[model samples]
Target: MSDALTLKAMLRPKFRGALLGVAVGDALGFPFEGSSHSFMAALGPDALHAFEAHRSGYFPPGQFSDDTQLTLATVESFLQEKRFSGKSLAESFLPLWRENRIIGRSPGCSEAIERLIDRTADWRTSGCEEGRAGNGAAKRMVPLGLWNYDEPERLVEEATLAAEITHRDRRAVAGAVAVAASVAYSLTRRDLILGEWIDAVAGATAPISPALARHFRDLPRFLSMGEKEAVAAISKLGYDDPATAPTTLVTPFVVPSVMTAFFWFLRHPDDWRETVGGCLRSGGDVDTIASIGGGISGAFNGIEAIPEALRETVVDRDRLIDLADRLHTLKEAVRSRRGA
Candidate 1:
């Protein structure tokens, strides 16, 4: 509660804020995945099952789906290995699948996991033909940036490798790269000077792939546009597939998923709560959108700003905080080794 807290104290909360923010957003948005903003708002956040119970009878309340599970697995891998390896991270994902711990995994990811376990193909060729570009690749990518913060080239390299483990499409890789760069750059400071933040993320992300490089170059134009105009401009990319009959609120495509999340994150650069509210209002794939957006926002805001009620609603507070602490310790160790 003291303003006198050191940056070290502040950073532990920032670390925990990023991961716990992911979990809170995942749980809060899970039940509303396919529902529109208007419909969900009518029912309210509390009505959506904030507590851990079975309104759905299949997924328990406050239980995060595939996004947070894969993220934690990725973090666990880093904690064990001290660096990123796509094979090691992918192997870590296997136990979750085997134990039925991965709820709501995309069909593409599920197929790839099956092939991976079969040992029938290399990871680059193992991405399922269908849904190759779902936000699945990008949704869980923030931890990469946290591990390799301030190292743009390394962030892009590891993020691309992480995405290709289950997502072969160029767009999926691009989305993952952009988000990871944003998370990495975010941890470098806490001030929300909006232009600097977007520029930092764009610079970190732009060199990854030609497709993403071009996309990030044009990111500022969209981010600077009016909310409705930005969404309209982004929709021109066809990520939402609105032409499909019975259109759902969310799309699996990479273009709009990353753009929309970026739009809201930039808009609410300092408010995790407001950023999450905006993400939920944007609808489709709400959990994924909110998780990435909230994680970034929380990275800037730190954990103290996260609502106590929402914090309590998430399932694994202690373990998540411990994981954050471990990651912070690892980062300090690496920094010490470099300075030595």
Candidate 2:
């Protein structure tokens, strides 16, 4: 059944769900990040769903990595100024970088933060804007759609600016637009068909770069395939760079990480548990793929749909909820000003 629940007036729960979902997904894959498929398989499904017991030395089991940290930072930027500001978003990152909180730094993002601190380069110029595209731009963009759900053009403009703080590649900007747009639509559109949803995302994204155009072009074939088939197909597409020896799935490369995440979410949209756990099961960059897929699934299904078992394990559940509520109240104030 299509969700009859009106979403325009009930953005709080969905917004909370989206951010909380990101954290949940990030935590899920954090332990298995960079592990080989054989390693993950040996860990088994029991380990995949195990909470508060991460093998990875970096975090305390349920704790999320830089993905959720930056996502929360993005939410904070809006709350701090009572509105969205790219400079604020870029500024928010510096503290994390300086505090040694970020798990691994994207060169562009790190450079942007450094430049922001020294007042040497503007956020626009400080970005490591080589032709290379990476996951840094896309991993933390969930809050952009939550804040500006009503405005796609504005979302595109704002998201691009925010992304340029670290990743200037047109492909990175395009990928961010696609993720933000998908989240934007979920906030309002209840009867979302899988194909049309991706088409809308691809349409908005493809115009920005040829690389993403090709990536999006190949996405639809997975629509009708089984989960295993879709995974295999994505692997064959070879979105990751081959030159990098011991190429881990948790690559900073934008294209494969995105396609892999989207394949899992699209495969099982209705079940939030499987959607997150399934992506982690695929291994390699487990946290980021799960974060992207989990956020989207959470936005579509609402936090209520999340299994209590999994929800119980998420780190800082109340804090995530509070951040979402703050964004909701701020969004309402903005609406009141316009008096729609």
Candidate 3:
């Protein structure tokens, strides 16, 4: 441990930033969840501010979707149990599912949660089947990074278990590991080295899905290009839903969505708005993509990097900050015990 002062000074703000980052991005991007590039472009140059002005009719302004809801469930489970518990995580997700509280939930996650609610399958087996690889798992797995930042093996185990609550595909599990491990890696680093971050994340992901790992490895190719060119290249890097025409929107597919998030975060590691705005401009699955990218950027840049206006707009902003503080406290205690 780097001493209590460093934990309070450096890590605490990162913890707050990561959670709130996911939420603010979720809320800001929620209104444009399935929009095409044209629709987003029509919002004009001040699209970020315009997002709130033209809120989705289904949800109130600044309300986050299932992404932040399930993420909180993970954080709450860790605080209450003081460890990662698949059973507790599953139990936490059930009430949200039953209450119709999870907004804009994907069909695969919905099916898996229904199985859990009906007792047709237990937590271990309730997740969507192997081929159903969406980003549902990765969105909520950031807490695992916060909890197990220094424990790689344990992070992998817990991330896999957490992903299995709603997704079982190796690609989906890989995506979860990548997102959580990216957060963990970002928390430990003092500077951003693009290649080093990609290598570490891809190495962690390789054991589960070599293809997904390869996609991450290929990210450096977009480094020199401008955002539009890079995002366009990133979109073509993977397959999306067959139903839709080819477009710049980041799909719900795990590989492309995860890569897009990675691209935007790496492109602007310290700028939360630019990073998340990059995801927003990509259009489809904006909430998930932006949430993932936002979490990583927040971990790197800390809480102050998020704009005051955007931070204030998030629902339950104070509660999210409190949870981050508690999680940081718990992490320090766990570290102290291990160091003893």
Alpha carbon lDDT of each predicted model: 0.75, 0.76, 0.86
Cα lDDT of model 2 by residue, 71-174, tens digit = 99999999999887877888898889888888744565676678888898887777767576777788888888887888778888888888888888887888
Q: Tens digit of lDDT per residue, candidate 3, span 139-208? A: 8888999888889889988999999898999999999999999999888787889878988899889999
Residue-level lDDT tens digits of model 1 in 1-340: 5543465567777888889888888888777787664665566555333544435778666777788998899899999888787778888999988888787778878888888888886766666553467788888887887887757778878888898888877777778888887887667675766567656666655554465556555767887787656655554454345455123244556776677677787787877777787677766777888888878877778887678887776878788888988988897788678872
Worst 10-residue stretch by lDDT in candidate 3?
A: 47-56
lDDT of 1 at 63: 78
Tell me how far the alpha carbon of residue 33 in candidate 2 is from the true structure, in angstroms, after superposition: 0.8
Better of 1 and 2 by TM-score: 2
TM-score attained by model 1: 0.88
Off by over 4 Å in 3: 1-8, 50-58, 240-245
Candidate 2: segments with Cα more than 4 A from true spot: 1-5, 41-44, 56-58, 236-250
TM-score of 2: 0.90
